[model samples]
Target: MAKFSVVVVFLLLSPFIDGLRFLVVGGTGRVGGSAGAYLCRLSRAEGYDPSDVTLILGGRSSSSYEASKARISSKLIALGLAVPSIEFLMVDLDTPIVPLTATIESCSPTILIHTAGPFQQRTDPNLLKSAIALNIPYVDVCDEPSLCSKSKALSSTVPAIVGAGIWPGTSAIMATEAVHHLRKFENSGDISFPCDDETIDLSFYTAGTGNAGATIVSATFLLLCQKALTFSNGKKAEIEPWIGSRSVDFGGDVQTKTVRLLDNPDVFTLQSSLSSPNISSRFATSPELWNLLFGAMKTSIPKFILEDKNLMQRLAVFSLPVIRFVDSFVGATNAMRVDVSSKSGNSVTFRVIHDDLEECVGLATASFAYEVLKGMDAGIYYPSDLGEEERKGILERVKKEAVLWDFETSYDK
Candidate 1:
């Protein structure tokens, strides 16, 4: 009788599960395409009804939308899964506020994933506001610190997770786990204050990863225009962008690479999420020549041009051809290293390396989407604050697609 009852309950709930829908705002782009593909694969793997769960690839025009559909459909077929109920939602965030909101509302996604970026230098929160009004959970792969902070403020009205991809997302979770281990295992020393004595260092290296489209180029220029932020000695610190350069060993065939400090959302989000008193983050690209050229530009470019969004974006748009050419030499590798230490004399380190940044980013975002599908009471969360179960799930999901993934620890004794 009990088994029959369970079967009956499953039958009743199956339809609700099948109704799940995912709408990717920048679906035609690398990040969005990767995510939409993986989300569809994962949904099927999790036993969700493939026919019921819709994958909406949002694009500005029908041509672009059809292109995205074709791309993701191929990816799904390659993975041995029939493409789910795939469709396109016409959405242009650049559209006027009301129509943009109307288009988003019309999709009626169970959870909206926002990957449209160069999320830098923007003050509008119309999409997020619409998500709030619609009362659906929203997730963003936002890397910009200021914009993340602004979006975070809307947590009271809707369920949201900001900075939910790659460095800012997985890197933050690694830091949190390292700190968690240190607080629980390091008792040899009398250092009881985890918040006052711990330090977290994050390093990232990417070799022409992602689509490197105009948005990526523009965001890169924008980051170069501003100062990098860090938390150290129990306080906040700001340093010149691309100044604190260092060599990072990414292990497992990736070897050592050079990285430089750049502002990332984790620099701000980790301050409140981890008990670590000190935190630092840095990023660098591959192909040494590019760094040299970027270095030369640092001093050669006029300050006004660097600081002006319009000018920098124009420069980025024009430079895409050369950037794409350089990418051939860099080989599309993305790596991250995080070191966490407590004065209690314990420490842990984590390294994640993937040869394909686009797919890896999709995996990371899908991991977060998996968690978002699990209902959360309306609130805002950083990747670092995710519960242990969710963290483990994301880490596991990441390993399935990563080329090299490692976690290590040590004690003072």
Candidate 2:
């Protein structure tokens, strides 16, 4: 049979019923949409009676999010999922908060996955505060370091979970696992992270750039060249992001990539959440991706190398295509990986791969959603706060529903 057919066949065979009433705030977006679709499919497979569940997608007018809604709903239908009744709204941060709360209360969904955001745009403190007041479990696939920092600070009265996407979710879990297993990784002098015997410099290749655009790309490259954050003897310090540059073979001739610094929220959260004296959230390059990035870097670097042009200038112009491709890809599906290593050199890696990027995103976001809905009666929390019992279940949830696996790298990079 054809590839699509095989997927459909498998969906038909998979067990489905995990009953819950869900309301997805940014339900039309990739991650939220994928979540809705997954629930619908699960509902279908388990022979969910309509009375058993209701997935109300919370988002703006159809004109604004029709494409996302269509994409998700269509996929759900294809997988033989029940057609969930979608609830559309005219939500903008500027809109009166009263109606938003009222709408939410009306649905009173047992779970709320909030994807709507002024996150990187202008981040609304009101929405977060109000969501917390409502006392319903809420989750956001937020991508903001400043905000993650704030969330880290306010893990008390929030009644909500922030940074619900891949980095904060799956990746955060990875760091937790690494920290949990670290047996006396007390390196107070070690500034470099994951300082294995291998190369420290990673030729980080990226698929997407979040709100910061190529500035992030430049920043990442710069991090490789500068001292990055480190924790030694249970204290934190800064070291060169790439002062310890070296190449480790990703698999094949990936040019033995260099690890570079990235000021992503994941790094901040990993630091905030994990107890690793040395937690570095850097980017790496796969061979194919690196070749592409390197070629772009070359043409632009001739001027910088010979004259007064800067690397950032070169990368910015060169990354025009990268910007478009990555944004679209990120917008299309919320998929990523988080790698964690212990000081004693033991490590495990986890990736949330998707049949579609949306699926991967849904896996990540839903994990956070699950935690919020099922966790203790706390105000606010990050994934790092999770206990060992909760941690195992969260990992299990992803591995079972989404396509996940435990891989053993050859004790290398």
Candidate 3:
């Protein structure tokens, strides 16, 4: 299963150069490819030589790996950046545990980044577990609650960051900033903002799949079948996904879009970390017809079919032709808005907009990976779990990649 070229060369040469090695699982996919490329670029920017940074793209298909490598090389060339040495490892998530561990061990990565997902159907965090067993620092862009929970359970054994992507990752960081802002304002004045009555609302919008891969589309379909986790008045509740529709103003060119409640892991983590009892995550995609199509799928499609990962993946792949056609006109803009408010009528709003979802997800995940590489305590953590300074650092790093990054505050007497 060890299919990497120059593995021995990397192992023999890496220690002498004080280099950084990243093993990105699902490295050929949209999110993983973007992250891998960003990591190389970031490493170079941080003073590592192009030869000093190594990227091992772990995936099952050599063709995909080749394509991803070419894409990354082209991007680096276009940006006038030196391309790091990249290798491919034949690794498959579906393989048995022992083999998978062996494959990952063969690379001896400094950090492991797991981005391979349609994480909705996975009942276990096998990749995270493998990283833990190997004692490799880990980061993942997981957006699934059960897998995140499973990863969290093993956090004490290893240093890991889960749900470290655009929405769940940066979005959580935004929520934390909002909470901190509100708390600071409260502490500075005589305002009494009770934690129990505070509310956190997350609204997200993307246009035409944001030029993402089928896995993301499949994940969305799977989410449509599940119950959205929300907190109301300090109590947790599960409601039907894609139902409670609301219009959100993303500001700038994104304008106002209609978003519906979606079962995102951020709500759960934010509620716990920020101690905000009322939290909900909502999402929408363009060009309006897509929203209607998703709503119809959520309500009209059978539960079993929607829950079928294979079926969903097939359906997503089948629909990509049409989706790409629509995407051409709609563009690939993505935005997220986090609103934090207290019963006392004080509130903070944070918004992040990116012209490309794939690139933003990569940058966000890379920021987390960058922090983890710098060193953190051994434990699993959500983006909100990061300390104030750490959160600020990640946000600052991501800000450069964002089309819009800003926050506003309002107080009512």
Candidate 4:
């Protein structure tokens, strides 16, 4: 009877042992593709049975929605993963929003990691509401600050943690930690104040990629079509996108890099989220990728390419051949540095290192997704509700995977 009771107790908790089914909406895109591929690998490396995961990739419904599933299933098999079913659901800015809600509901996903966006590039009330309607722990890798800032307002509606990718996501976490750890309390140091700020300085850097393909192209059109919101000293100002370019060293090998203010969600995200009196975000790239940057020069004749909707498609086709062509010297890395200081003479800095950053953003985003899913209870939510312990665990996890370094110093005022 005692042994039978034990077995029954074990059976009762069996549901808890199941691996999470992460519904990746844009699972076929750059970030999502990398995430779906890496997630299983990451899960396995961490001792999770990767087989336990179920990935559903959604694309615009073809001639027959059911027909695409076989092809998608074959691709997953080729990757040596289980046959993840591809639901031929039509998704676009115009697709009905409730279907998104129903699809999510049908999946009954433990979490939703959305990467399919150009929300800021093109705002859709229905799509945004559909995303909001899911109301079950939702996260996005959106690179638009407008969406990110607006996402914060929806926190009461759903646990929406926007900017789950690098800049606004990890960088924000780093910024928060940078703010907290860089300053020490004076007499209050004896009591251990986590943070007290009278002054702040910060710089954000991303050497990998930003607003690639149509997203960049379209947002630039938006800038041309409307006044770009300029953020300076925690206030909204106006500025032009390409014209406001500045060259700053995103710091070395990736040295003396020139950066421009690309239309990213992080810009607005940091603006509204932090109390910093001085802040600037730097967009960067390796010198070898000058062509891609040149492609970004929207005002130039080369700008014709920017008008092409097939730009990302062409990139995918050519990326492989180009990389192999330059394999001997085609090196890439992603690094971000945050330097913060207080009036008294205190400072904290963290530098993250990664070899391939396109995938790094996905990794960082997915890791955060995993944690958010693990920690979320029922109803809506966002990262703001995370307690200190959860925050520390996330920071530590990012630091470990990020291979980050920490250095601090203080002196007498």
Candidate 5:
């Protein structure tokens, strides 16, 4: 059988399930769409009945419903999987919580997956607050540090998971696991592999990723306009975005990309949650021009423009033309590398690469959603907070869709 046939066969033989409803905000968009698809597949794999697992695609308008439905239908047919139950919902986050609340109340989904975000300038957690009020499990692919902090504050009252996307989500998990593995070196007979103190370094390379639309572009602009927060030398310090740089080889010389520091939430979140004092996250993208342009803007643009949220977002909107053009040629291959080093000199590195950024991101989010649905002692939690067993379970699912690299290398990077 061909590779595609094998995948189809696996889907056919997978477990079936019944009675689960997922309301995906921005379901018509990239991240949400990928997530909804993967969640359905994974749910089926876990024995959920396709007919029973309802997916509600919540968008601001129902205009795109037909096109979105068609795309999903095509994908399902290609995979030889039955088309699951799906619904279209019109939702606007701009409205008051009362209306949104009523909307969600009517849908009565088991869980709400909040993926619609530019998150950069957003400080209000109304949507999350609504989830709390509704008493439902909530997850978001939020990358903004301030919003994460704000959402986390409500943990005592509600079950919410923040930064549940690929970078901050799965990347954080990989970092935590690396720490665990490096610590084991202390028991190894080899003294050279000693483990005591450690550092966590995360690097990512995305190719015009996040097909979610202009929100992703705006989010990128927002991060670029802000200072990157990194934990190093037992302190959290803000550094200029797109400054620190390093070249990372993405296995077998497929590509060696230059990654630069960005305002990734995982750096600080992991530092505060984990024992590692030194934690940093850096990112770059294919079609290096985008990085060049961003770097140039950081230095050349007026601080006033960068500081103004609306202005930055507008800039992002304007830059979309060029970004989309470049993205067309760059191709969507997303890769990440996480390194954990102990003070005693032992370290472990884990890397994962995916062919599609949207798919990887969606799958990553879905994996976390799976755990949350399976019943996590919810309050606010990041991937770093997961227990070994839970983390392993999520990883097992993620590894199926990603290229995993866990190996030793010379201490020199």
Candidate 6:
């Protein structure tokens, strides 16, 4: 009878014992590679045996994939963490939907994390659609508006999180928490913080390529050609990109950097989530000369060429040597400041600083994946969609990995 009972228990627990399989598309890239490594680290922290979690690094190039795997293993070993099972799957997102879907299906991943991007030019939510069709949970570091909208449209059909990277991911959560704190203060009757004319300012500074790949450079150049979307008194407006500069204090070694308005999908989601009347996102890069160079390119380069994604990518690749030489000096330090304020002068400020953009983005992305895999309900959701408890949990995890995090409030007396 005892033997039979033990067998039944093992049979019932087999699925859990077998563990989760994660398919990190673009896994060879900085964001994807960091995400996969952090996933392994976080899973180990959760007490899972290293063998229980499997990471399938999906990329088109086998050589790059192998290189990424070896690098990830070395990093994990340096941290004294055991490496999880890592595999490779050949996935070409540029291919037709049929072949891409088939490649994804071959992995049989329990969850799919899409990090491949230069999302600026991608019109179709092909990966999201594939995940829906395959009925696999999905998450992405997409920062593009149209793609995010298309992904959100499919929210009802699948369990997924879009814009799950650092800015659109953790930044969105920070905005939500700021608003919540303000409202809680208002409700306490300490002050009347009306939401009639709320404003949100997102300022970001990434030092020279942030030790990321060429795709980031391509995205930056592409953004230079696009119009920035901002909300003014609850109305939609578009302004020229890389203009409307502001100086923000990130309050650390990265104090007081100049940032110019940039287009980001987070603006749309934050507007809807907080119903803020005015919102804008701005970004800057270090070695100030680079900012000047970007400005010069934006004005001198023909709009058509800058708008051409493939051409811009090629330019970025060609410029990598110069960018890396600069990066060596500026060091990959990154910071973000989210300022939420009301017309009445009540405000909440949240700031995060990290030494490496690639690592922070990966950690933030992995935090979302951890939540989804831990059983977030089936639905398409933004970072703001996370409930209070869920938001706190995710933020806490991010804070642990962040170099510095601070929150402050000021109310007009």
TM-score of 4: 0.72
Once superposed on the true structure, which residue ranges of model 1 sit more than 4 Å away at CA?
1-18, 187-196, 210-212
Task: Give the range of the ten consecutive residues with the poorest summed lDDT in model 3.
Answer: 1-10
TM-scores for every predicted model: 0.90, 0.65, 0.93, 0.72, 0.88, 0.94
**Pairs in steric clash, model 3:** none
Residue pair clashes in candidate 4: 143-265, 144-265, 145-265, 158-381, 159-380, 159-381, 230-237
Question: Each model's C-alpha lDDT?
Answer: 0.78, 0.53, 0.85, 0.53, 0.77, 0.86
Q: lDDT tens digits, residues 1-413, model 4?
A: 53354345436754884455666676655566555555554566444566677666544545423443444455457768665433333455455666656765676564567767544444543434565566455667766555555556553343446666665577666666565555434434332232344233333444323423233334334433233344544566655554455554444455455555445444455445454555555455544364354435545544345445355335544554544344335444666666666556666665666556555666776667666544343323234334456566556655655544554445455
Candidates by TM-score, descending order: 6, 3, 1, 5, 4, 2
Q: Mind giving the per-residue lDDT tens digits that candidate 2 earns over 134-244?
A: 655577766555666665565443346677665546667655665444322433434334334311111233335433234334544433333355455456556543334
Model 4 weakest 10-residue run by lDDT: 208-217
Per-residue lDDT of model 5, residues 312-413, tens digit only: 668777877877787788777788898877665656778888777888888888888877765566477877777777788778888887664555643532
Task: List, residue by residue over 221-326, the lDDT tens digit for candidate 3.
Answer: 8999999999998898999999888989999899899999999999888775666779999999999998898889988889999998999999999998998899
For lDDT, the strongest prediction is: 6
Query: How does candidate 6 fare on TM-score?
Result: 0.94
Whichever of 3 and 5 has more TM-score, that candidate is 3
Supply every candidate's count of residue pairs whose N, Cα or C atoms clash at under 3 angstroms.
Answer: 0, 23, 0, 7, 9, 0
Q: List residue ranges in candidate 5 displaced over 4 A.
A: 1-18, 156-158, 187-197, 210-212, 307-322, 409-413
Please state every model's RMSD to the true fold in angstroms. Answer: 4.1, 10.5, 5.0, 6.8, 7.0, 4.6
In TM-score terms, candidate 1 sits at 0.90
